[model samples]
Target: MSTVEPAAPDATTPAPAPAAAPSAVEVRETQREASRRDEIAPWLVALEALRRKGEPEWLAAQRDDATARFARLGFPTTRDEAWRQTSVAALARTRFDNATRGALDDALESMPAFRFGGAFAGREAVFVNGRFMPELSSLGKLARVRVRPLRQVLADDPDALCGLIGAAADDDKHPFLALNLAAFQDGAVVEVPERYTVHGPIHLLFISTGGAASHPRVLIGLNRNSQATVVESYVSPRGAHSFCNAATEVLLGDGAVLDHVRLQAESEKAYHVATTATRVSRSATYRSHALTLGAALSRHDLGVRLEGEGADVELHGLFVSDDAQLHDTHSKLDHVAPHGTSREVYKGVLGGRARGVKNGLIVVRPGAQKTDAQQQSRNLLLSREALVHATPQLLIHADDVKCKHGATTGQIEDAPLFYLRSRGLDEEAARALLVWAFAADVVSKLKVAPVRESVERFLRERLPAAGAVPGTRA
Candidate 1:
């Protein structure tokens, strides 16, 4: 679990040239369709559809706000200032067939990662392609907590929840977020009462079987002095080129705590765009760990806001990619109140022609004095073709704050590889060991044993032969 600096690449290798610009016809077609699709998926569309079916006013207003923000800030491309390093032009070519509204019982039963029966023994909510599967979901009292589908929650009491759901997501220029805002269907809602603590983790499984896109939203509320842990998983077993746009929001009350983890392992031909937003209150604690593998193109945006004094937050994440996979992460830690602390660490292992990007931003306002924040990103390249962009930024208007940011891009150390080989281990085994050890710093932080083990297995299977699991000697 060492946070060692990744070794620099040898000077002998040269970087590859950038891909050719996309065709004008292709770009124009996609942009036009994007505008149309954005409108179709906005809250106005959802609200109108719901109203025609006799829905409520508060929900409609929530939709109005979301749609207005969406319209204000439209889809973003790599050309945009924030997305300059992570080109999403490939998304324009993606055929993300929306997941049809149907019974996914068979898909759920046959899923590779759907192991909720044992590990997720308590109430579990299952969604295939973004729509809730009542039969697949086990909703009930779990470890002193009540769990139910979001649609049910809204039906019962929309006024109490609309603000929480809609307020968590603001208008991001990211197309994926815009699409999610427009197209999301049902989701899960977990409520923990005051002074309660859920002994086990709440598991939410999102599987994209095939056909249609999946936009799933999740909400969790922890009352004062309450504590809980949530694990979200996304997987696609059958289809190639599937698309998953998912979002989650966790609201922590005073003195509450939440440990959240998201594991994304989609098919090689798939595309994944996910966003997680957490708002922490006074003296609350929030920690998040993300493990991403697979997917031809994937991007995750983590936005955290410390809104009250004495809030503590940590974001630990890692992604291992190969075979032309593209992965990106953009995180913003906002210190809105004084005496809050935040830390961010992200690492990636890239091979083949895979590319990765990490953008970590820390914003401390003028009156947010006594704030402490640290951000760091590191990446390991497994091949000469691999590329990574690491940018760590800090905007601190507070004169009395302690903040620092750092980033690095490098590969496995040749000396370590040679030394391991001299000990009689083969080259492939030696490299794999080093790569695993390099990624272990983030993996070790996963509190859920099963989830952590699953991530390790994914890395072993996805990383190339040259990647070796470091020996116990290290």
Candidate 2:
């Protein structure tokens, strides 16, 4: 037939042969992919602005890597193995603007509650909405230790961060960590030279204001035989609905000792997520005191690697949740060398309809003989509506390792309550005394005086009844 060749279909015209319809699973997956994209788009937008800055090539490359990793990892869902018991859907659903300079309210800054005295006033790196504020901060006459802002290092000597910036944090598998690496504006960079001892504890104070998202980063390096203490604290105005994604990486050189304290007391309307990674060298010691409260939802991941012989790690964790708040803590202790020792204890106090979760894993690798690891999770539920979930695990590949894990979750024991009541205490005071006892084990681990006082103040403010206990102030 001499039929003229059909004109090619126009751009908008459909082809004569129709494509096969997508399967149900394929359709569902496409929707999920789109949702994930939506969740990450805001952060990408924020990163774009940061990329325009004249940052070092190496830092740019690191950010690019983190961006790719973030896209691949996406946001963790309850369907994921590690997130099965915790859902970040709310955090993922909200689209947040990147926090900017001048985000802190002047009136808020002048509030008596925000003022600090003693050690915190001595050496502090202050950040409001992820931007460093030198006006309100002081480096405390540092000698051999370099306690400067991350922005300073990124600009003055990015070479210093070549191997240290992203060393301990695993952004490849953790989306939040990747997000932080991609979007962090400024943070504290602490460097303690070998055989030196920092005069005082370095305080990293990060404040979150409502109406946006913040990314706070900290990189700490303690050289051989060096010693230092660091306190990473987060707080916000009451009723603020903000988002804070923080990451802290620490490297302890051989024979180094470091004490880390992390306190999170955000608004009940806020969401907080953080990751802390530490690598300990031969005979190095790492002590941690982690306390969490006040966020509507919060999750903290702590990972420690004993890279050389005789490395030791001791961790104390406490979480107090009320009014439907949810706190999730996940810790992993990896013993890679011989003669490693690790001890972990986490306690929880829940009231109202609150919930608490403690997930811990201790792994002893092959040839890591003489490894000793202990993990415990103790929880106290204050009401019938409160709930807690604790999962402690031990994975050992070496033959001569001593590893043990246990968890206890229950309401306040009647026996202890009765005893406290018999000691001329009212029901409320009695209950508070017992609760304090339950939490004292972990709270007492904070060695820094200012930190201890601050945490105690928070506990009292959160639970007025707890303030009436014997060992508390008005």
Candidate 3:
């Protein structure tokens, strides 16, 4: 049996001095050894088990490569450039067992009202603890489109999923991506054929029951000239402290169009990290809306690559953090071909002692002329104790590109509160209205009516109560 290594000590703690002076060479070697000893081994054991279960040789090789990468990178710290603002040491210290094989009995009847009765009423796929439960799903037949559990696809024809799974995501830089590649058991797979258009959006629901770790992977592909919309929802029972690591990859063929909506509302005690990678081909379009509202420590990474001429991409995100929660979002858009266009707008609201971070980047590669890109990040602090950090960047290699970026972080304006109060609104109602208006910029971009309304309702229920902030008195 292989033994797992323990988590490293907190970075904030000072290291003890050596009894005897040591050479610099010896100290470097000792640091390397310590790093190796901190690698998580149980996750490797689970990966090996999956490989030994008769998975394809290619997949086994991929898992092995990812395992090595993850071992080298280990868990990130606040010292790391990408993680300089957020600390994940607490998550690393927690030892989480792999999820067990079981479905929640109340999964069907307990589906959240926000998820059901929508335009996507009977077209939802449900997964509990990273395992697909067909009994709770209602995915009917659609022309020129195929939706199936990823495990089923792997079991039937593993080769069919090749070149699409890890094509857009880079595990070398992100250890979480490596972890997902090494241990993800099952998720959703969607394929739309050439020139086909799905009338309704496809909904994927993932729920966790706490006390374990779940890795969920979603793969979506749209052939040339096809169009589809996908909705992904992540939630958990209140007070659950589970750990969730998820990755999603989307491929758009020439002239294809795809709209994606992601909703994350996990337990207040849960740890959640997710990455979304999208690649757009010639004349293709890809748009995404991300909403985050729950989790003790949550991070979402969005990466988009415009690899073909005339491709377009847009990203919109909103996050609300309360209590002592922490939420972070990092996004990157790469324009590699001529005539490529990209835009991003993210808004965040922080209350109580909560904190939020937003980092957005736009890159136009060399020889990519006629590239148009813009990024904006806006934040609101509902309380004096709340904090936020916003960063927006633009990297243009071509002189003929049009690129712009901006960021703003502050509290609600007293003018808006006074105006609302003058309109016969209570103090609490007025405050809530202003907060919603700040978030409406992102929520209004949602094309799905039910999704937009549900998100609005959720924000209304979670926003800080009236007069929660000390200086809000007009």
Candidate 4:
């Protein structure tokens, strides 16, 4: 081979400029193309179908933007920093069809018992397969409170819906949220005007049918000095294989107070991913209780932003996993203003080959002086193969702030078990007693009596020899 001599450069000629970097949009399109190769075409088809159904121009634009965002971010893999502890490869590989209509008649007739009636009474809004079913919903007589289907609200006032849809939770960071915004058909909308206090809790019930995927969206807003209590329950028929991607956004005005509870008890073969974002204004109080008891793989992302002075937030969560199930709860509380207070307690019980994860973070931004924040995560493993990962972190960039975080992962202490056994309790009974006692610390924080009772019932049904516990309320 003959070597070619290099051409000499001219003194008056300038070197060619380096190629410009790809624009953000172009880079995003490249990512979207790569993600589409991972079997995300079904979702793309679903979004197109929604657009072809004559949706409002504004809504369609929003959906298009969200779809683009989702395509860019794609599904999170184990390689992602935020998802390093969790893997959703199975969910990404599976081809899921969107739930377009309500549940079939036979499916509705064979529904399971309603365990949350006591908590919501007659003020309940029911959704089947992600579509609102007015016949099954009973929004009886709540003064100064509006509870309606989200689709109806959107149809009536697109502007109002647009204002609340992406108010909390940035879709740019969470791909599932972008998917939800792109494909959600119907959900619940609850609004409380200024100085109004709802008499009873407004309940939102989401029931999934087998096979298809459901995207549920919930938005709750409280005007100045308003108060309300809301409960959102997700369930599916036994043995159903479904996918549920849900998101809820809450906005609390000045001096407003809200008590929110979210319960996820899906089928064993189901996939459940949810995000809840709350913004608390001056002197507002926001309390949340999250319970995760079912699903083959589940993840809950809870975020609270204390944006105004004197805002208070309390978050309580309990998760029980068994038989190879994975349940994860990630919480972030940001104290951005002075005098903001936040408290978080999360507990997990893992049995069989199950795995549990709890990640709680408390952040005190600069100028957030006198911010009192505390977070605790406690986990118990009942089987040798069971595993739990607990991470409690405090990031403080401000001085004169009181912030503490603690995490513990271990098996039940021998001393407590021995004490219970000495009191004539069997091994199973003692274990159940200890587990319930651990979970009760979070459940008892629920101020609502009926809600607490329902959680107790759920735990009793799942725990071994739970009925043998001494007291009625664990």
Candidate 2: residue 350 Cα off by (Å): 0.8
lDDT of 2 by residue, 108-188 (tens): 553346444646665787888887888878776677788888988878986878878889987766889999998888888
RMSD values, in order shown: 8.2, 9.4, 6.5, 9.0
Off by over 4 Å in 2: 1-22, 106-115, 464-467, 471-474
TM-score (C-alpha, index-matched) for candidate 2: 0.92
* Model with the higher TM-score, candidate 1 or 2: 2
lDDT of 3 by residue, 1-474 (tens): 122111224446345457588767568758865864564565566556655477787887888899898877878877666788899878877877654554264334346653657457567888887878887787874656888899999999978887777999878779999989988889999999999999888998888766768889999999999999999988887777888899999999999999999999888999999999999999999999999988999999999989999999999899999999999999989888899988888989999999898988787888779999989998999899998989777777778999989999988898989998898887887888788778877988888877787787677577656334222214
Ranking by lDDT: 2, 4, 3, 1
Q: Alpha carbon lDDT of residue 330, candidate 3?
A: 90
Write down the lDDT of every candidate, Cα atoms only: 0.77, 0.84, 0.83, 0.84
Residues 114-197 of candidate 1: C-alpha lDDT, one tens digit per residue = 663367765577788887777766656485687777777767876667567756665445556655655567788888999999
lDDT of 1 at 222: 94
Q: Give lDDT tens digits, candidate 4, residues 217-329.
A: 99999999999889898888778788999999999999999999888988899999999999999999999999898899999999999988999999999999999999989
Clashing pairs in 2: none
* Stretches > 4 Å off in candidate 1: 1-52, 68-72, 90-106, 140-143, 172-175, 465-474
